[model samples]
Target: WDLVCDSQSLTSVAKFVFMAGMMVGGILGGHLSDRFGRRFMLRWCYLQVAIVGTCAALAPTFLVYCSLRFLSGIAAMNLITNTIMLIAEWATHRFQAMGITLGMCTSGIAFMTLAGLAFAIRDWHILQLVVSVPHFVIFLTSSWLLESARWLIINNKPEEGLKELRKAAHRSGMKNARDTLTLEILQSTMKKELEAAQKKKPPCELLHMPNICKRISLLSFTRFANFMAYFGLNLNVQHLGNNVFLLQTLFGAVILLANCVVPWALKYMKHRASQMLLMFLLAICLLAIVLVLQEVQMLREVLATLGLGASSLANTLAFAHGNEVIPTIIRARAMRINATFANTAGALAPLMIILSVYSPPLPWIIYGVFPFISGFAFLLLPETRNKPLLDTIQDEKNERKDSREPKQEGPSMKVTQF
Candidate 1:
């Protein structure tokens, strides 16, 4: 209970344990969601978080607190993974970026809310309970949420898929849905996808295919670097300002603004380009923090805030791009693989902060370099802007082939050339 001067390291240990739990959750949740349905997993995770997170608040001892937190971490990761999948599945390509961005913006809102709550409530247990209780509402309402039609069809439940589609169409005021939307039409529409889904692929299939393996490997590394830099800077924020609450609010505000701008920015730039640009910007900011004289407190704080915002934007891009590029059949598994890398870096970020005691610039230097490397690595992956989501490995192959084929000259162009 006494996490004071002698036991301060226990705080870091608790964080590390929580990240470890998330890492495990990413793996377990991904497999389960892919095996079950996104709606079911989402509801279960909400309930788990509600119960486990509330218990964490009332823990009797530090050990009990950490254990509950670990369980809560698992639910939290599952919540994130499934929520993103659900959002991607529901939103059309035209609105997918905006949908995911809006979902992610809630984190920024939560951060600001936490800053306010932590300021208003001095008791840590009360703050924890306050946040945990809301999930109960979410879990109760989750029953009304529709299961993903894509998941239904791909999993060989065409009738259920058709029923869900009709419900959606009816909700959208499409009167013809009852007469027009039939099981045969649904099967014909997704015939290629349904056929491809028949062969169940393991997670290892990601590594076995050269193109997918390369993309996954690079994506995993990018996630690792982004999270390490992001969390390292976050953990080091205490040194940047005297008012933790004020600093936290500013951080959240900047992230919210950055996410709000992303949907607009994606309109002009490809996801790969935006990610590279942000990663480079993040690297420059981290490096600048080391170069800036410690006497100039204002400049350092500005750089740190900008760096955090850049990292947040880059993270959003990575998530959106991954979902877009990865085939639906193995998308959850690929996300799990990347999240494992991210949570691993997240676990070590606290340890990197510890290095600041021995050498001030050492942590920032390491953080600065990883993003710089990953920025270029992003160039290796294909651009997914304006592309339809691929449902199977064969779909990905066909897309790649289409992309590679040279465009034939139009009649107008031929006449002009003649």
Candidate 2:
């Protein structure tokens, strides 16, 4: 690539076209996930990776490799989107932060798994094959998976929705309003209550709450900035050298391992505190990029490895945090928009690599501000600690209201888990 670029041949504009493709693909996937349901998109993602990854792995030419890799990027963000909405809606509120954090941690674990694999595999093509197979099986089981209950209820499918809710609660061992234990009873109650509510007035007017647009804008912008920094790090992985593949696999293993473990930690740490802490960690990680390039002579790879893992965890949790706060009726819409901007950020990340042609730190300096400030800003945000995934976008709007008046006057708001 440097050889081609140095000859006044390859241009930043050309490099960024791939990024643009990735961004467009992620936005498209977000909309598709909302329209079809999370499991559908997630299941399809494995198939996509299998096909495109195979093609790229075998490609003998640069053009084929670049094109196939671009296509792979399209399939890339599905795990992020579906997992956020899934765990946010399905996880017990008391453990939602831990759930999302642990979910995010899967990236770490996958990294560790691969580091071990690299000792044996020694080839990117073979490693891709090893990694892609199990995910395909996981995708198949996704066929029997349940859609999100919070999404269903908010979308007004309270009957089928409540059934799924009861199932989730049972699995989580959560006790709720007695009706929540039985779908038949919950639906019967909702059917009568909704009918009665409708007799007086419509349940949800599209325009009843207008601030939704503003909230989406905020969520989208935050996601865009956050992901730009996040993906920029990923995009530049090759800059760390030929051994970067092993480094990345190791990073994924760590993330996946964290996904396996952090749930226990979240059981104790508050959601808001965890998010702020992760954001601060991400900032420090980004800052360390400079130190790795400077002071850490032998440990640069180690520093970058930790930085990558930290960035991924923070990037994921931030999305989980944003998704939970959005009103439910428009949850999909809001998430799509958030994902769109994040993809847009991703599209711009490779551009930062192109800009590295001018000055290496220029991109890092500009990108680093995002995670650093996001942490500070998040510290000022409301605590979603122990808050159950909400039932509806309307429910989110009225979150300040009591489930069934806010002022019960307790030491902490005893948020219900569903």
List RMSD in Å for every model shown.
Answer: 3.3, 7.3
- What would the TM-score be for candidate 1 when compared with the true structure? 0.87
For candidate 1, give the lDDT. Answer: 0.86
Worst 10 residues of 1 by lDDT: 409-418
Winning model by TM-score: 1
lDDT (10s digit) by residue, model 2, range 1-418: 3446464324444446566666767668765875677766777876787777767667786667778767776776666667766887677778677776766665666555766776788876787678766666776677767887655654567776767766666666887745645666655655744553344334355356665565566556656666777676665666654576576775676556545544544456665677667656766766666656544434656665665666665555556566666654456556766767777787777677666667767777666777677666564445565787665655766775554374566757576674
**How does each model score on lDDT?**
0.86, 0.65
Off by over 4 Å in 2: 1-22, 34-40, 79-103, 115-215, 240-246, 253-277, 291-295, 386-418
Q: What is the per-residue lDDT of model 1 for residues 1-418, given as tens digits with 9 covering 90 to 100?
A: 8887868778778887787788788778877997899999899989988998899888999899889888888888888878888898888988776788888899899889989998999898888899899999999988988999999999878889889889888988999997899887888889887777777676466567888878789999999999999988776667676677877888999999989988777667889999999999999999998998888888888888999999998997788788888888877677778988999998788777667768989889999999999999988888998878888789989988998999898876765533
Candidate 1 C-alpha error for residue 375, in Å: 2.4
Q: What is the lDDT of candidate 2?
A: 0.65
Q: CA shift at 80, candidate 1, in angstroms?
A: 1.6
Off by over 4 Å in 1: 202-208, 292-296, 323-332, 382-418
